[model samples]
Target chain A: MSITEQRPVISKLEQQELRRLLAENKRIDGRNPLQYRNISVQLGYVEKAEGSALVELGNTKVLAAVKVGIAVPFADTPNEGILIVNAELVPLASPVFEPGPPSEESISLSRYVDRSIRESKSIDLSSLCIVPGRSVYSLYVDLYILDYDGNLIDASVIASVNALGITKMPKYVVEGQAIKKTDEYFKLDLKDHPVSLTYAFLDDKYVVDPCLSEEYASDFTVSMTVKADDRFCAIQKNGGGMISPRRVIELLERSLELGKELRTVAYRQLAGGNG
Target chain B: MLRSNEQQQRQRPIVVPGEYVGDSKFHIPGLNVYRLSDRMLATTVGLVRIDGKRVDVVALKSFYQPKVGDLVVGIVKEPGTAGWTVDINSPFLAFLPLSEYPEKRIRLSRDSIGRILEAGTVLVGLIKDASIFSSPVITLKGKGLGVVSNGFLLSITASKVPRLIGKKGSMLSTIEKGANVKLTVGQNGRLIVHSEDLNVVMKVKEVIGMIEKESHVYGLTERVEALLAGRRP
Candidate 1:
């Protein structure tokens, strides 16, 4: 068994070569730095999921599914219901992802999206609990990284937001100890919407939603989650290199710009779904 | 007096947060706001609140969250010294310890915990508890909860689970009868079917696959049965 695998170290000479490519505003794959890979979002793709969506960004593909179940609240937080988010970077999705417990990267990926939804108050968590201290409904959002090209965080976030938008919870009526469910359903209450935008700093110039090739050449990655109200909900800085404060500002502005477009695309695709 | 009060209450609508009181539930799919009292305007997200006169609703959003006591299907990933970790598709990776395993027939060996639970093992477990510290912990000692091995992992839309299960296990019974495959369904879309005949298993898996895909259509059970019957003998 191998002791922990180390990420590839970029030599000084290689860094110079990548920087030179970026200075020219040209990607090794012939894409302009700001250009995103081709993206496609399919809604209601998983028939088993209450609300499901598949998002393909370049070669990277992710599927998100939403399910609801009855549950008891935590002892401390009995009044509030629960929302569970699970992210799986399947070994099939990428070779680097081992078939074991969720890596820190995958956990962080789930958290970034989870925080955005929670802070945005996308769903009324309190309403989910049926009996304050006793039982309640819990919403589970699971994201499967089926194919990994690069920028899974962004793809997963997009798929989840759209899937949640398309989600509908079964209606329940509580009579004494028995809980009765009706044939009715309701959508989530996403007060302030959140969408994630990722940028890979290839060479030195930043590229919007990098593909696998660009990710290979890039040294730093940034994921920015923006709310519908134009507020920054979450920001994750990845990659091995250090990001200068000036570069952070630049990426933030670019993320906002790109986030608006991504949100519109997600809404349109989800709205057009036959739910 | 009681009859007048009942009539008045009927005239007023039932209100909830995030729901909009419109002419009907189909008016808006998301949250809707209605005036309850002069100072109390509640919000609703699902269904409309209308009796006959006043209506109260907020918005209607899909309700799919996780809570305690849910029978979840999860993937086994990290095997640690303390326990084997499972990803129940939650914000946190649910952990299952070897100690929780029931005392059974397998010979005892003081080996590594990770060795006993290699990665990729699907587990049907109960949520024992969750901690805000790091991740959620799960238990496998309960009835109908154990290690899932040697089966094809199938997924369906989370919303379709109720439909697949039907009211009081009706839907699953029909699928089992038609496909002749023993299946264990997890609420999180992870399903496993076991059968001795490889061909029959494959056929049954396909039928389940179709059911999962076409569940939104009316008469899904009939369609699944027809597909199963049409398979080669």
Candidate 2:
């Protein structure tokens, strides 16, 4: 129970209602067992940020903003650009979340989202390298959770990728070793589109895209990130529950299928229906 | 009728923030429209309603700003000595004082206060006092008010509450008759649909969603009826 505080206690009556609905293949909001909620992505809401997207998945809302700046790269990855993902679980989003430094849940969320984007090669980091050993462009993807209705990982992943898609880095005039900043900006080239799929472990069943109520009622959840080209990037099993080897395999196959369909939704929204 | 009406009104195109509408000298800037230098610009995204010489920007999404005498649906979060903290879907939680309670208040008694309004208890009441400097005050003193224990709550955009209720309760009557449920609508984008059958409550929720989506368009009542009757429009 790493979630010591800020976790809403699930009442017995509410759990019974949700469990009964799930057993009957009926969700609280009338969605199918495998069906995800109504997801819509609004791009470029924050003007000050280089890129921004407000993603609405049913009632769960997440805002992703990217800030581009010049900074020194890490020692080991000096030649490549940097990708930093920070998540804020603001108390205003849900009564359960607290207002302070990032909690354990938020830190884990940011790391998982970061691994999916970095390992999948979503952004071409090498191209962001203005200087091999010195200064490089650092992109910060900050996720602000505006609403908490469960399955936050999937929503945050999509919002971050969409924000990265719309990010524009400032251009610099390079002369020998000196670089001067210019008013012009160039869109960062996004290589791959990765989407995440989350499934909650209920009693002897796996429910995909669990709502807030269903999430609290469930025992554990598994989140899988897959690329558009059918490549799996990262997998995380949250909560203290054991899963059979057969169930793990079964989950991976189902997640891949859903990932493909969701990738198109995210890609199309980023391209304004052109994709 | 809709086509002629739209033409006669000279419909203003939908404008977003930073979009130029007209000159400030000729048209007075309304809500969400700010004057920059000599030009008028929109500060929010919504449909533009140009009335004579005044231009008003009506945002599609409405945030509830509290005012006195408005009926609202609130949920009790914490019980205090004199009043209970009720979340009225606003930036601030309202106070349901002991005077507004249906039961009489016992002087300096905490046990009696819990009996009146406890945590998780839903109430349908009216705002008795609202001050910018203080938390708004609510009262359970109106008809069809007090603890809402049997019904389900559904919310839509505050701007569409008028459309869902229709002009003079005509649209509301259509929904109630079509779904066979007693509906109470709040101006702050909350509603209570009471029906014995769970399906009727669900049907009313879908109808309200249709009203919100098509509120900007004309002839919404017929489409809403078609949705409730399970027919294709």
Q: How big is the positional error of residue B200 in model 1, measured in Å on the Cα after superposition?
A: 52
Q: Against the hidden true structure, what lDDT does model 1 obtain?
A: 0.69
**lDDT string, candidate 1, B106-161, tens digits:** 34456666667666566788877765665667888989988765554555655456
Q: Fnat of each prediction?
A: 0.00, 0.00
Strongest candidate by lDDT = 2
Q: List candidate 2 stretches off by more than 4 Å.
A: A1-20, A38-71, A76-81, A86-109, A119-152, A159-194, A199-207, A210-222, A226-275, B1-70, B103-118, B128-134, B141-143, B196-202, B213-216
TM-score per prediction, in order, is: 0.51, 0.64
Task: Write out the backbone clash pairs for model 2.
Answer: none
The DockQ of predicted model 2 stands at: 0.07
Deviation of model 2 at B43, angstroms: 11
Candidate 2 displacement at residue B90 in angstroms: 2.6
lDDT of 2 by residue, A1-275 (tens): 46556444343334545566667776667778888888999999899999999999989999999999988889998888888999999888887788877789899999999999999998889888888878889999999999999999999999999999999999977788898899999988888888999999887777888889778778899999998778899999988789999998998899888887887876676664222
Query: What is the alpha-carbon lDDT of model 2 when measured against the actual structure?
Result: 0.83
lDDT of candidate 2 over B74-125, digit per residue (tens): 8786788778888777778889987888765466544666666666677788
